[model samples]
Structure formats: structure tokens, C-alpha cells
Target: MLTVQEIRELIKVVDESAIDEFTYETSGETVTMKKSGSKAVAAVPDNGAHTDHPVDPVKNSQPNIQVEQTEVSSSDEKPIVETTADFDHEIVSPMVGTFYASPNPESDSYVTVGSKVEKDTVVCIVEAMKLFNEIEAETTGEITEILVEDGELVEYGQPLFRVKKK
Candidate 1:
């Protein structure tokens, strides 16, 4: 079995490099890393099947991706013109783990919608293998959206919060 530190190092290397996919196998255990869209996924084998989990990987800044949706008018008129809008900066999970909105159940979440944050501010916690890791908002902004519920399982690179940059 690979140590947690080893896995973290691999994730860091893969995240920083331009390589799109990577895999490693040893002693019947296999780990695969792949980048898709803006998300990076790491998979490990369980009973001959691969299960994806989040791992500690640094986020790489990329240009905003725009998606368009078309809606028909209620009167059956022509479709409205497409409008372009920029997306907020996404705060992603650094590892696969259970998301906790607060330090404890009784505590308020680190941040909520409209909550302003600095680059070093901790926004949430992710628990993996009994280890609780604090996640930070690497960009200064106001929280615009929280993508996951407390106690939910989050995959590596999964967006946890969307921040409207200051």
C-alpha cells in the first residue's frame, strides 16, 4: 500500500505538469490519475474495480469555461439571444474525503453565501482516513455558492465553493 505522503507527492506532481493521465501499480495495488475538464480524479482499485477519490493536489489556474443554455419563449417565439457571463473562482477540494461545513456539528460553517474571504482564510474541512484537513480559499472573494453539503463525500478537484473575486 502506498503511504499517504507518497500519494500526496504524486498528486502534486501530476497537478503541476501538463500530463493528462498517469498510473502506478505496486504489490497488486494500482493508482491512476487523470485530469478531465477542470477536475482531476484519482482512482484506486477495490475488489477488482476502480473507485475514484479525492487526493491532495494543488489547483491550477485555467481560463473560465462558459456554458450556454437555450430556453424557448413561453409564447413559442424565437429563442432569446445567448448571453455570456463569467464564472466565479471555484474553491476545489484538495483531497477525496468527507466534507464538513464547520469544525464541529455545533459550529457555524466557516463561510456561507456572501461571506467575504481572504486568500488564506479556511473555508471548510475534509476528513480522510480519520485525518481532518482544513481547506483554504486561495483567492480573495465573497462566497457565492457552496457546492457540497456537510458530511458529503467530495472527490479530488471537486468544486466546494464558488467565490466572486473582489
Candidate 2:
């Protein structure tokens, strides 16, 4: 199994090079990465397990969606106001794993919305192949939002938090 740092290094190398696609298999785990224009997306399947349904890579591509909020005012003449999500920074998952907001079931979350964090702060834990990896903030900021719910499966490069950088 590749460590999170190793996986990150692989991603960096691939991004710096002209590789369009890359795949690696180790100890029954398979990681596939594909580059789309300037960004790269990764998928790691557990234990080389095959899904019952065939996956359509194009249709299954998970794109980041910006949440839009609309507000309506009631008056003699009413108009709708639209707003889009905006954040200074995004903390993305470095590997495919199950996201946990805390170290243990009974423990408090490492950080919550409005929590101030340093570059080395541990914001969450991601479990992969029975190993619990503590993920860092990597930037000085205040967390504005937690994107993934607890115990959610996260893909590599998936945004886990929205932060307002200091």
C-alpha cells in the first residue's frame, strides 16, 4: 500500500509530466488517475473489487459543483437574489479513503466551521486499507465549511473543506 505522501508525490509527478493517464495496482488495491485539461481526477477501487454495474468513466466523472443560494423577497413587486459559493481555499483529499471528522467515535471533531487552523493542524482522518491517516490543513486559515459528511467515502483530490485564508 502506498502512503499518502507517496500518492501525493505520484500526483505531482504526473501533473508535471505529459502523462494523460496512469494506473497502479498493489496488494489488491488499484488506483487510476486521468488528466482532464489542467486538472486530474483519481479513483481507487478497494481490493480490486469489481462493481456489479459497469462504470461509465465519462458519466461517473465527479466534478466539483458550486452551491448557489437564491433568496426571494416578498413585496408589492418581488425579485430573486442569487448568490454563489465563494471560498479562499479548498482542502482536498490527498488519497481515496473514508473521511472521519474525529479520531474516534466518541471524540470531538478536530476542527469545525469557524475553527482557526495553522498549516500543520490536523483537520481530519482518512482511513484506507485499515490505516488511519491524519490529514493536515496545510494552510493558515479558518474553516468556513466542511464539505464531506462524516464516514463518507472520499476520492483523491476531492475537496474536504472550504477555508478562508488568513
Tell me the TM-score of each prediction against the true structure: 0.56, 0.56
List ranges where model 1 is wrong by over 4 Å: 1-3, 9-86
Candidate 2 — which residues are off by over 4 angstroms?
1-83
Candidate 2, residue 166: Cα displacement in angstroms equals 1.1
Residue 72 alpha-carbon offset, candidate 2, angstroms: 45
lDDT of 1 by residue, 19-48 (tens): 787878787666776665654446643221
Residue 50 in model 1: shift from native, Å?
A: 25
Clash count list over all predictions: 2, 0
Clash pairs, candidate 1, are 54-96, 54-156
TM-score of model 1 (CA atoms): 0.56
Residue-wise lDDT of candidate 2 within 57-161, one digit each (tens)? 111112342111111121121122222446788887756667788777777899999999999888887665455677889899899888888877666566889
* Worst 10-residue lDDT window, candidate 1: 66-75
lDDT of each: 0.63, 0.63
Local lDDT at 71 for model 1:
19
